[model samples]
Target: MHGGEPSVHFINSVLVTVVVALFVLWRYRLAILGGMRRGDSAFLPLPAERAPGRAVLADGDIAAREQAMRQRVAAAWLLTTAICSLPMAVAYMVAGKMSASPTYALALTCSYMIAALPMIAVSLAWPPWRMVIAFVVMMLSFAALCLLAGIIERSLLGRPLSWKILGLVPLFFDIAWNQLWMAGLFWLLSWPTRLRGVVPITFAAVLVFAAAPFAGSRLTAVLAATEVGTPWVYTLGLNGVFMLIALPVGWLAWLRLGKLAADYEAKRFSDAQLLARTWWLMLVVTIGFDILAGRERPTFALLLVVGEIVLFPLVNHWVMRWLGVAKLAAAKPAPTLLLLRVFGYTARTERLFDRVASRWRLLGPVTTIAAPDVTARTIDPGDYLRWLTGRIDDLFVTSRASLDAKLARLDLAPDPDGRFRINEFCCRDSTWQATVIELMLRADVVIMDVRGISAARLGCEFELQQLAKRLPPQRLVLVVDETTEREHLKAVFGPTLEQVRVIEIHRRRDADRAFEALVDAAGGAGSPPDAWSAGKKDGANQAAP
Candidate 1:
């Protein structure tokens, strides 16, 4: 528009938009998806293959809700991607006309601009009463930014940008560009929302480009400064120095807040309570980082602030994930994944940001529902047992209590106070310690929850022979999930394996026949007598499947 070459400008803008959109889409892809709870780094990821995992069911209980929940999360991720990119179209046009010889700079400038906006606007996604304070702050930021930009650019560049302050810095510093973008992004990335774009990764790719022009420039100054061009190096270094201090501190604040929220929620704090408190903690960290460092070493402090603001979440997320996996020593593996994880980890972390903001609270509504609200009331305890065995399956619900109750009903389960007890545990949470394996050891009759469980080490059949040997001569109850059970049953069981009794549990509380059979066979004690199965008649076939 400035040059009046509308066609050329249009073409360039199109490219810019495409590039910026791609970066935003990829950079925040994981966050968008994770917001729906697909890959809960602290818990576990349900398989995304879309094929049902193992299911142990009786005759009628439905237990495929886990699958559906995962899918919904994936869809949410896709939606987030859409929301983030829709706002970046403006930046792309500006980038297209800025310059093209330094493509990387052009891209970086566009990306920074694009990345910058949504972070500021995020405060608006919520209402003003609860979120109002944050939004007002953002608005003030926009105002102050306008004043500063006018002084800086008009005097410095001899021209002025419209709403330049709003364009660069988020007015609402707490949920401003850096904080909101990073927090919201991390919240979604850690789950299984399905955002299939290249934006998140594109940002990383841009790093390579940024570093290209300055390669081999970080040499020891004393040894070479007198000979060649080291000033450029110094310039780059100086710019970097400005970002080191405050940036890191800001980022750390975010990480700490998120991790704290997750820790509290897992301990069973009401979600509403958690949301309300988290906002205060987030604000404290924001203001504290600024007050403590923003005033002392203003420039370096700002650098640290910016650095922390941008990088801390990534570092913290990686650390948290490593901790969750039970690694004795934390390892920094993939920076890209860590960055993405930080962007999405917030959904599980906490919601203080939404709570304290007076105007924004409406959009970030948190309902305090108890466990009963999320329960599958229609399904009974017996049906839960069947569902756990992969007998009946639905992809829409999860009943933690039902599953827990099934395991608790078994006499063979470890003592609740004992070290081996895994009641209320899932293989998703651990690869080796599910209760199904323990039940195989001593109980003559087991009401196994096969819903969402697998048959391999990560499933119900983790340790096969041991399961049979633990209750040798007593029947090894096979509770199979309906979807995959048919295929598995034909393979794991045979006629001669009389000690193996495969009971198809239907609905919850429909376990009467299974209990009665076990009782009659044990003459009341629930133990299998000698020659319970086809005995040694099929010893070789005992190794079947």
Candidate 2:
């Protein structure tokens, strides 16, 4: 067999695929094992009742806390940029024999931080749509930043700077193939899918590597004829490709470091073990990127790169610790949030969940039923992929034993960011009713969004009856809208309906009101004896997650 070393694309693709696949499978295995290893009862014991601290935390109080977290997230995003970019700045400074001024280095770093601010805001504003936003907002913002950097650099070098530099923005992104890579890579980076499926991320990387160069060449050739300097085009293209590949690798490595740190926070390992694990993961990721980027030989530059990679994680860990994510979570009780909704309300249901989930750690974890259809509403890529691959049986619980096992292992803990997950009960037609009853008993507070509820939704009707029978009215929040059939709902609950807290939400403000009611029901710092039950019959508010 006449064979040469594998092409860069082939090697990179293989490495990405293997790394991603193994990580996904490993996480999946851990999930299954977690479920099996739980020897507790099918549901957690109910939390003991406590006296209400204050009459339901004020809306402003909750808002202020949420705002604080957003600040932390923004700060973390900027810090991440600084950690990765500063190392490169140092390398450039050294390579240029100190020709790179500290002012310029500071300016470059400041430019990156400025560019990232808008994206961070966009991400925080709409987490569910972050992937799409990254594609549009991130690329445009990054292009703008590059243009500004170009202007500054030209001015510093005593070279001509004009509107012509704008032409080179597209030329840089296109010729460097950054535009293509950003579209795919950013989507992967901002993936809303909690499963963290690598199929799309790696697949996109491979496609970009294989196709961007040819496409970029034709596009740039056209741009090169439009009064832009040929030298600038080549320079940007040459430098941009290295960063195109390296950025994603660095970000991916950060993701791994996060997982390890989370395990440490959760007491999965001691200090020494965490250090060892972090070092091993960082080494593997750094070396993998180096090899894929064609830096196979040992050199001083490579050594510097290694040091940068090593320092990056240390900074990451420090930032996380400083943010007090673990300490904050530890102080809060992660009560189970039981979310029940009318079937076929996927869009509204997800919007509801997104609203509450943003501050869920303040209350507790969430539990809900997996809708019959998988949509972007709930990013379950692993479940969606399995469905596509005809592994439908794996998506649903067919037996009581399986449902019990699922409930036993269900985690009600917050993630490293102090955000809790919506643990879904994927049940078959035969077991959903039973699932509903068990979840009702286990929930600290039940949020049932019966918007558009009608006589025909027998399953929702059944859930209503169980909620009325098992959960105290003080512990339940009923969400309704104009579409809901009130008479039918009243028929199911009888006199009990009078005591229940009801939120009629036709707008965003109503959702905020509803969130407060749920917090009161969950017995957080602000629950009054009748805080939620006041005016039970008047219009109120609702959500699904």
lDDT of each: 0.30, 0.54
Q: After superposition, how far is residue 488 of candidate 1 from its true place, in Å?
A: 7.1
Give the alpha carbon lDDT tens digit for every residue of 220-258 in model 2.
666566666566567768446445545665555445444
Among the numbered candidates, top lDDT falls to: 2
Question: Model 1 segments beyond 4 Å from truth?
Answer: 1-241, 247-251, 254-465, 468-545
Provide TM-scores for the models. Answer: 0.22, 0.57
The reply for model 2, stretches above 4 Å from the true place, is: 1-74, 92-99, 114-314, 361-363, 372-395, 456-458, 508-510, 524-545
lDDT for model 1 comes to: 0.30
**Candidate 2 — worst ten consecutive residues by lDDT sum?**
1-10
**Candidate 1 global TM-score:** 0.22
Residue 176 Cα positional deviation in candidate 1, in Å, after optimal superposition: 23
Candidate 1 total steric clashes = 124
